[model samples]
Target: MLCVVYKSPNKEGAYLYLERRDDFRQVPTALLDTFGKPQLITVLNLAKREHLAQIDIHKLQAALKTQGFYLQLPPPPENLLAQHKASLQNDKG
Candidate 1:
């Protein structure tokens, strides 16, 4: 399967994948509004790829098949303070 990827202009590290290039018929208007204007990224052949850097290939494919689109959100920021506290507790035990 082939997909077109678009980066969100308002969001960093957010991407939208569609089964067809520039086709947003299947996507909801509210989602599109929040996603902001999409900037062209690339066209990808899912069949040729075994893995994706941020998204799971299988899950992406499934979403495309069922929903005609997939939204990739950036991972949550790591909390260093929480990690440090956990480490201190561990050291005391």
Candidate 2:
């Protein structure tokens, strides 16, 4: 199936994949408010197996099938800096 991907301007690294590029009317108002204006990213073909960086093809397919869209949120930071800082503080103490 072909899917249209939209990137959220308000939230960095957030994406919305939908069946129809122009059909966003079904998306909830609350979600839209948080999502902000969606910028057209790319159109992709969803096969059984494919190379997707942040999302699983099966999961994406299921979401698009059930909810008419799939939302991808950014992954959390590694937080190595915080751990390093804590270790430094412990050493100082």
Candidate 3:
């Protein structure tokens, strides 16, 4: 399926994917408020076989089918060393 994506003005790397271009009616008003204004990004074909940098294509398709929109939040920043130490402590505890 072809999906249209919009970038949020308020958040970096945050994107909203919709089933169609120029349609935000299915998006909740409260979410739109928090998302700020959306800037058009691109339209692409989404499929389980496709690869996306931050989002899973199958999950995006499921979300779009059920919710009419799919939200792609930025990937969480990693702290590998800190996480390793925390894991060691947990193992000891």
RMSD of each: 0.9, 2.8, 3.1
Number of the top candidate by TM-score?
A: 1
lDDT of each: 0.96, 0.89, 0.90
Cα lDDT tens digits, model 3, 1-93, are 899999999989889999999899999999999999999998887753477887777888889999999988888889999999999999999
Which 10-residue span in candidate 2 carries the lowest summed lDDT?
A: 45-54
In candidate 3, the residue pairs with backbone N, CA or C atoms under 3 Å apart (3 or more residues apart, or in different chains) clash, namely: none
| Higher-scoring candidate on lDDT, 2 or 3 | 3
Clashing pairs in 1: none
- lDDT of candidate 2 over 1-93, digit per residue (tens): 999999999999999899998688768889989999899998988763486987888889988888888889999988999999999999999
Candidate 1 vs candidate 3, TM-score winner: 1
Q: Say what the RMSD of model 1 is.
A: 0.9
TM-score of each: 0.95, 0.81, 0.79
Clashes of 2: 0
Better of 1 and 2 by lDDT: 1
Which parts of model 1 are misplaced by more than 4 Å?
Answer: none
Please state the error at residue 13 of candidate 1 in Å.
Answer: 0.8
lDDT computed for candidate 3: 0.90
Per-residue alpha-carbon lDDT of candidate 1 for residues 1-93, written as tens digits (9 for 90 to 100): 999999999889999999999999999999899999899999999999999998999999999999999999999999999999999999999
